[model samples]
Target: MSGAVWSYSENESVSNEVASAAADVAKGASAEPVVLEIGAVRAGVRAPGAKLLLKGPATSDVPPEVAAEAIAKASKQLQPAAILIGATRYGREIASRLAVKLTVGCLSEVSKLSADGNALAGERNAFAGKVVAKVSCALPAIATVKVGYYAAVESAGTAVTESDVGQVNPLVKVVSREKKAAGAVDLRSAKVIVSAGRGVKKKEDLPMLEELAREMHGALGCSRPLSSDLGWLPEEHHIGLTGVTVKPDLYLALGISGQLQHTAGMKDSKVVAAVNTDKDAPIFQASDYGIVGDLYQIVPAIRKALASRR
Candidate 1:
């Protein structure tokens, strides 16, 4: 029962997040928490416990296929208690492959993780975030952790250690890596976010909301339809169960109807304030403050209020 608890993520930000989760689980299980670096030590990827450098993949571009092989090989020798991977697109694939390669149980997109006796217990959202189910698996299991639930731990860690996984042949090769769309932004860590939805009349009007976001020193986001259906914004701006999940200090929604799919992503936000023309819009139920008015009129008035303060 007293073995190492490992955390791994190709993403720099999510690496720290996963490490925080692993540190807590390791504490409950009375095991050491280790952050595993795929190819080289990333300066940005800091965690709570020891750092392990797996020196096998030529570069950090180790595909999920190769990452699984390396981690599986290392786990066999280290005999870890559990492996927690960040629940990003790449991390999900790596966790799945590692679980299968090592013949271990795997949990996906679980939050509030803890060590329960000889099992790993976590909460998973179901029914489109309407219901949360408690899930667990025996020791030596693999789990993909939900993001934004835990704050990143940047405390000092033990001295780094190195292990060579030897050579790994990837099932797929990464010939090129291009940046996301032009307007893409990493909304995970944004403290304040003003999101849009179907209520906006035209794509040209988005700048009005964008200006408001800038005045508030917050980022702009959107529900799925604004990006996926209407193409008013890039996919990165989309917020929903299928899109990016965010937990901001304040989420100011304008013209958003507040469907479950959209609210699911930002449910953890500290304060939710929504403005919708429909007084009965579902967003009001989820919001801490709801204004039944037109965003077009309300936004200008709010700006005037802000200006008067100055």
Candidate 2:
């Protein structure tokens, strides 16, 4: 019962969790689990009792064709009972292509997998985080496991084994990569966020929200309509269930009517405060603090108070 795990990084910790999970699945099964690392420059992984293999210093991100070829080579040699991959964007694509090449069934985003008698049982969420279901598959299977699902465990294992390097293909060459410029604050990781909606109207009114956010030492964010419809803010700053999910320490929604799609993404915030003219707005239900008044008059007054304090 041989198991295999792959990584795109030379650093073993990148796929260490997946390797450990593979080892756990292969425990007491009379087979040695192998941790295979595939890097542009070099590839190697570590576990207490499992086998570790490092290939070369190839590159950082693995190209789809190269990943497919590497998995194919390892499959031919190991005949692994199962292969476990992290369910990242790249991981999912690689696992799917490898499964097709290896002629095996591929499970995706599995939260749990255990060998039960003659079958492998998998538990995962479905229907957009609404339902949980279990699935079963036979041996020689492949699965893309969720990152935070299972804990990585370590135990005793054999000494390291060095395998000959596999074929290398340098088809697509990366020219360069650059990071995007950020504003004074980035809302994705902001501890506090103050957002506005269509009720604020006109692009000119955004300065009020910006002032409030600046006074609070936070970033200003908005709903899709405010960003996309009016072009008052960049689309990147939009926050809703369809957009980025934030767990800010405080989230202030001003002039925005609460929609479930928007709230679902922000409901996990530590503290939520809302300012809307309508007392019956859905935002009130989700807010830890609420102020009912016209945003035009109240927002400026709030800004003035904040300015006075500074």
Candidate 3:
């Protein structure tokens, strides 16, 4: 039997990146015109003529429980063939809770989805994206895909009537809300990102990275080993297969060797520049611009040149 793939929508993700991936999967399904369902929480775009429904508003941080209840409710109404969610923290939580409640198989961090005969196929990262492992499951399958794994594709379809999920009062009420101070810079959304690796030698050397980022109007990022191993930078600033997948307009890698795992994360960036002492480093292959020199001299020169211009 064929099934539908559903994605959660959030207000910030109106781009519909996640929803588009779901539609792309639906197009390939054996089922006729895959059904697209959006939860009350808006993340991405709602496809035209797609079945839009309210799974009840999320109780802020209570998505796990809220999503479980919503999925159970949606199951009765849509009876989707399969459920697809993003691999985001909240999305994963929702998928996990729903999977346990429904007692069905669930795939996480899938980069590709397809059909192989009667079974569903999924491609996900393993050993830090070193290998792409393929998996399959029977019908009524559920999955959560990673961001940047699949690009959103346009499809020929129109919007359908809203399902009007009918409000179900939340059993759990949010007792308190704490807002953490925003970081010095929001690197995730920054157009340019200057990331460093272990080659920086010491945390005191980070000022140079920050200086370059300032001149370029970008934020700072670091490799996994540098941040996790040395604690030089916060975990939030790490970017790589083991860290964050970033698609900035411009990415400058200072002292980072382009490991397959690290390269996979930022491969989507529009422009990549690398500054490493070793000209044969793997990062140079992915970089649009390369500077083979000591970061100490190169970074200061670049900083001075920019300061002179400013």
Q: How accurate is candidate 3 locally (lDDT)?
A: 0.71
**Which lDDT values do the candidates have, in the order given?**
0.90, 0.69, 0.71
Taking every candidate in turn, the Cα RMSD to the unseen true structure, in Å, is: 1.4, 5.8, 4.5
Every model's TM-score: 0.96, 0.61, 0.75
Question: Pick by lDDT: which candidate is best?
Answer: 1
Q: Which stretches of candidate 3 lie over 4 Å from their true place?
A: 1-3, 9-15, 28-46, 55-62, 115-117, 150-180, 184-191, 201-204, 225-232, 257-264, 267-272, 277-292, 304-310
The TM-score of candidate 1 is 0.96
Evaluation by lDDT, superior candidate among 1 and 2: 1
**Ranking 1 against 3 by lDDT, winner:** 1
- Tens digit of per-residue lDDT, candidate 2, span 1-310: 4344333322345366676666556665655556655543233344555453435435545665666567667677767777777766567777887788888888877756666554556787555344578987777788887654454554544465655446667576657755534553456568889988877868887897888888888888888898777777876678875555566899999988988767755776899999999999999998999999888888888888877987
Q: Please give the distance, in angstroms, between residue 296's alpha carbon in candidate 3 and its true position after superposition.
A: 1.5
lDDT of 3 at 176: 77
- lDDT (Cα, tens digit) per residue for candidate 3, span 36-108: 3435323334343365455445332334556556666777677777777777766777778778878888888
